[model samples]
Target: MHLSIIAGSSGLVGNNILNQLCEDNHNVIAINRKPISGLHPKTTELVIDFESFLIDGSLPACNHAFICLGTTMKIAGNKNNFRRVDFDYSLDIAKKAFESGAKKLTLISSGGADSSSKNFYLRVKGELEDAIINIGFESVNIFRPGFLTGAGGRKRATSEKIFMKLAKFLDLILIGSARKYRSINAEVLARKMVSTLKSKPGVNYYYYDDFIK
Candidate 1:
């Protein structure tokens, strides 16, 4: 049976991915800030403060690892704190996962991620993507989805809500390269990530429309 480790199991995409893994009969080790409730029989939950989580032999060995950790500047209270979660902690776990024998890595990034971008959020994502790639996974898959649509019981910022509305209105107009910014459901994205693990080994990049197909 295939096995995978998922970080940020409490978030929308992460939680959905965890459920999909269990439904597929794959064993899952979920790393979260707190224990997840109603976990499936094949799921194992590990709780630890991201800031102090250490890499040791205790971490289970798996074929694939998913990094779904992320935070917004507003919720983080400051830019530094936001980067701490988005970059620092995520990279730490990625490195540990690699060391623990994970061959394939998947990261949930954003649509406009660019290392040279003037926008802080996208810049951090781009930087994290580069760092993770350099760590040398046998296969790396980076997903850059725009305006994720999902129900996770979490409050959304006013700006995000407006963006979602605008995205829906523009959905019919966007085409070609613009389709990469189209909005998608979190469950759809999660399923794609889990299902594509057995595909050809290489660095694969998926945008909004890629998940739809």
Candidate 2:
């Protein structure tokens, strides 16, 4: 199947997803701000500034689209900039892909996404999910994985890095609570996302454990 991916070549999830899609023999187009290196023949990279990317009627036809664009506040160094990358850029790509005849959309959200959440990160993610749902896609799969374990171009803050190290032990005990913190390998999430796209068409939401399961 033909697939279009936005932001799956930089972060751990996106990079793994892109590689898996290529291995599956699917035609994949990767859109990002910078060129991706060492991709398979089935993969094509499109580099353009996200802030001024013009869909302008020029996009490859695809059956599915994946939105994996995200950034942390530390990396962005500004809340607004972080939101722009994590929310605005993702929405823009989804809107454009939908307009370009893509039907299925898979998004990688956070674990505690809630529109009314007190946490800024989760609130933003929740808001983005709501906005995407309102955009009217035929099928939407939202995967919320916790403490992603993978290597990426972006690095976590020192505090988050320490928290992740500690969470490794806690994750074993907090297996089934709403506040349960589970860590999923980025490769695992990537495979699941692709599998979901290939399997069926439905509006599905998966939390942290569910993603790995």
Candidate 3:
């Protein structure tokens, strides 16, 4: 019975989150770069050019904001462009949502994220987490699941599909502490996000156990 803002609705995790949000009866404002169709009845879709003044005062007052936008260095063309999407764009949207009265924030971050890591990708993820944590939201949920499965169509490559299927199957044997390293279904994480809309104040990190459960 709350309004939520969801950016990156075209992504595997975000799309699933959108579906679960609607099923839970929460009104959603879904932001996408391109036009889309066939979403749930509770969703209001906005095709936006991120920085243009289009969304300036148009976004509704929301209870929570979920940011699922991210891209690999290869897909983004370089580290700079990758930062533009993962860091710049994400932080911008978070600020906007907070300004519009969203008190809770949910972000889809990768596992092994470290601000000082030698790995560039994980470093960016860590930096984004750092930026949003201090953005004045009452609650922030960070999901750092490893090897996100069920991204079959999003990957759109034969080898990638095979890898994801293998990862999904391997989830059976990943037990105990090793469970944190297990591949998790995007839909499971999405449901977890929707279920935690009213988490306690401050930051919460969900690994395989908390999110996949």
Candidate 4:
């Protein structure tokens, strides 16, 4: 299938998806803020600022879109900036993809995403999920993986690094409630997202345990 991906290209998940899509001979359009080195033959790269990228007939006709865009507080250095990457940028791409005739969208969201959650990060994720659903795609898939595993680009903040390490151990102990804590290999998550599109559609939401299994 022809695909367009946003965000996470520099991150573990995005990079894995890009590689796998190219390997499978799927036509891919990768959008990023900076140039991505070593893309595959089937891949086309676009470097542009997400906030100001105007849709002036550059996007290809696509069947599916994957939104892997995200940022942390440390990377963004501010809550508002973080939200811009995590929420606003994602929404922008989704809207443009829909406008360009893409019928399916898959979003990489966190496990605790809840529109009514008290936690800021999860709440923002939930709000984005809700907003995307309201945008009315023909098919939507929301993947909520746990602590992602695999290496790419730069490491996250020290605290996040420590948490991911600790979570790996705890994942073995907690089974269900902490299922979201289970660490998922980035490649596995990407494969699952792409494979799901082949099935009959509705809004399919996969939690961490569901993804790992």
Query: Would you estimate the TM-scores of all the predictions?
Result: 0.92, 0.90, 0.91, 0.91
**C-alpha-based local distance difference test score of model 2:** 0.80
Ranking by lDDT: 1, 3, 2, 4
Query: Which clashing pairs does model 4 show?
Result: none
Tens-place lDDT per residue, model 3, 48-138, is 8876733453567888999999877668899999998999889888988898899999999988898898999999999999999989999
How many Å off is the CA of 203 in candidate 4? 0.6
Clashes by residue pair, model 1: none
Where does model 1 exceed 4 Å of error?
Answer: 54-58, 157-166
Q: lDDT tens digits, residues 36-90, model 4?
A: 7778888888787765664343456777788899987877999899888899888
Candidate 4: residue 56 lDDT (0-100): 44
User: For model 2, what is the alpha-carbon lDDT of residue 72?
Assistant: 75
CA RMSD per model (angstroms): 1.9, 2.1, 2.2, 2.0
lDDT of 3: 0.85
Candidate 2 lands at a TM-score of: 0.90
lDDT of 1 by residue, 100-167 (tens): 89899999999999989999999999999999999999999999998787766257878877876777
Deviation in angstroms for 210 in model 2?
A: 2.4
The runs of at least 3 residues in candidate 4 whose Cα sits more than 4 Å from the true structure, single-residue gaps closed, are: 54-58
Q: What is the lDDT of residue 117 in candidate 2?
A: 98
